[model samples]
Target chain A: MLARVFEASGLSSVQISLLREHTEKIRPPRALFCPFPFGLALGKPNDPEFQHRVLDHAFSLLERPSGPVLEDFPEEIVPADAPVTPAEERPPDPAFELTALRGYYDRFVAHHGRTAVGLTGVPSTRFRGLVRLLERYAAGEEIEAPTPDLSAAQYARFACDDIKAFFREARMEQYPAENGPQIDAWFWQQTAMGPMMRRVRDRMLASGDRQVEMLSYGIYREPDTPNPEWKYLTPTAVKTDGG
Target chain B: MPHLKHLPDMKRNEMLTFPAQVNHDTPWTPPARPLREARLALVTSAGLHRRGDPPFVSNHHEPDYSYRRLPADTPAAEILQSHASAGFDRSGIQRDLNTTYPVDRLRELLMRGAIGSLADSFYSFMGALRNVARLEQETAPAVAELLRQDGVEVVLLTPT
Candidate 1:
């Protein structure tokens, strides 16, 4: 859509797409459909060579003298591709995990000069309130929304994202060798937050708000369930290939 | 594999009928110039904005049709994402901005002469806009005009 507009307006455009189905529908002038999951348009975090390779393919499409070119990049990077070395020991609690990872997170900020923990619009120092909301929700209590405009489930979803990001970035700093999906798999499939978030989703559904039903989907997913797949979960398109 | 195929029996039919717009004529433009001489710009649907910028509404009932301008010089830390979709993975982006925006990698390309200069500013819109009639009609063209004003000859768009 936006890509089409840019091309229609005379700007040479190319996009990296996660869901080929939707791309096929919109038929943007040029698209490179990646097998990577949603939210990961490029191959990996901290992998510059791969990123450049993706870019190289994207840039090359510009010279084809073509219409609505949609092609697949040859490589596929999945979380299952990473080697899993167990951490020394799992932390007993999210708070404990947060405490343990702060030093590394601070170092990441000092060295990289940025952090991705601000989606909540709440300060890093005030993030614990959001965290506590999740904790109390998981403990089977009705919870209030962190921000005024959203429902508890909505804020819980974003809060968990922020908390997961905070912890993931710190863990990445400690173990620079770990890939993003590997860390994410560790957090969601193997950590306390995963089960806790699942509990939050259960409660949200139990509470019975039509809005929370959809928002709860992103809060958590189990190891091998048929949960929402972000790839074709585009705003309007629903995929039909059973991956 | 197409994602909708993997949905549970109950949700598959409803999801399958969601009505994504299909354009028989996808707009097209070939290379206007050599990559090394073109002024490139990044346009994304990642809901990215500078930290202090007004956050996009994460409301489920509505999509934010507005766009944000992120200067090429904005610090990596200052760029924040407020995409409202519940389905995408955030870990890759949370760890490396390149996975989504690739600002640093684009900079490297500029330095290495893989291509020419970058636009002074890049653009972003929130992801998963359920209704984009306004976007296709207004905001997007407005953005195109901005790119034209910047002399951006090439654009690389990454969607969340």
Candidate 2:
């Protein structure tokens, strides 16, 4: 939506979209469809080459000098066979232990209490349940189905997001007006939960369980690119002199 | 193009019934100069904000129609994704920040002379807006003004 506004204001705009159908429907000035999973629009993590390629394709649209152009990225996010460091090869961050997560949560509750953390619709009591699920998943054990109130997927979301909230709030309190990067670095690299989540991802990949895969990476299917049959607005083609 | 075959026929029908936003009257504005001589800015609906900035309100009952400004040189590590949309998978972004906000890649482009310069700041807003009218009338135009103030000639947007 903002894309169109930028263009309407006389700035050339291009969008990299995961939902090509929606992009085509909205008809941004220029759109590039990437078949990657939702959050990873550019490419795999730590892969600069792939990210640059996606950006390159997106930037090329700027030269088109037209309206409502939607193009497909001609690549798939093939799983990279990059070597995974063995668990022992990587030293653990003492700060990210389960106890530390609990500590942060406790500190967060003590500081801001339930009123601040309850927004996620996850009661504070469920923190332990979330941790247990993470432990089980990281250990490669079968995860028990969540109770009717909280499905397995919801449990995962609660765990990850709640932990993030705890860390964010705690950082704000500690730094008292510091930049966010310090807190972010601590959460992802220094926290025990970070490695734990990575382990969970590794385990899920190794298990090859379809449901688990979906929960971790999301449903991977082809994007619904615009076709001639769909009723879409195609602006009259106007040739402009190269400026 | 893949058809919406996976969706139930009724759901597909409902989706088709939903109105799509198309404005045929908006004239195309071509860049007046080459990219290497134009200032580029990034505007994303990926719900990205600088770490210390107040996070976008994701609660469905009360959505925030606000945007965040990320400085041109802000490290990808410092940018956080707080989007509440249930549609996209976030694992790739969680693992690598570049997937959503490619600040580093844009910098590389500037160094390589692929683009003339980067805007002083980029903009981000959550795309899961229930208040489309508010966005169109207020937030977008406000951001566009900021972009104009920064001399942004081209924008690259990554919509979540």
Which number leads on TM-score?
Answer: 1
DockQ of predicted model 2 = 0.22
- Tens digits of per-residue lDDT for model 2, B50-130: 765655653223456788888877765467666633244444454446667777788888999999999999989886453
Write one digit per residue (lDDT tens) for candidate 2, span A1-243: 677788889888778876566666576778888876555778665688988888888888878856677898998653222233333433354233544455555664465332223323445556556666777767767665445644454355445565555555655555534333345445445566666765664564444444344334321112242211123322322111100
TM-score of chain B of each: 0.87, 0.84
Which stretches of candidate 2 lie above 4 Å from their native place? A78-97, A100-160, A164-243, B1-26, B84-86
By summed lDDT, the worst window of 10 consecutive residues in model 2 chain B runs over B1-10
lDDT (C-alpha) at residue A123 in model 2: 58
Q: On residues A1-243, what C-alpha lDDT tens digit does candidate 1 reach at each position?
A: 888889888889989987777788888888898877677888777789999999999888888876778888998754344345455455567666667677888887787778878767777666657767888977877777655777666677778777777777787788877765567667765666656667777876555554565566555544443433343356544433210
TM-score (0 to 1) for chain B of model 1: 0.87
Q: How close is candidate 1 to the true structure, as a TM-score?
A: 0.83
Give the clashing residue pairs of candidate 2, or none: A38-B89, A39-B89, A96-A191, A96-A192
Over 4 Å off, model 1: A81-93, A138-152, A223-243, B1-19, B58-60, B84-86
**Clashing residue pairs, backbone N/CA/C < 3 A, model 1:** A114-B77, A239-B4
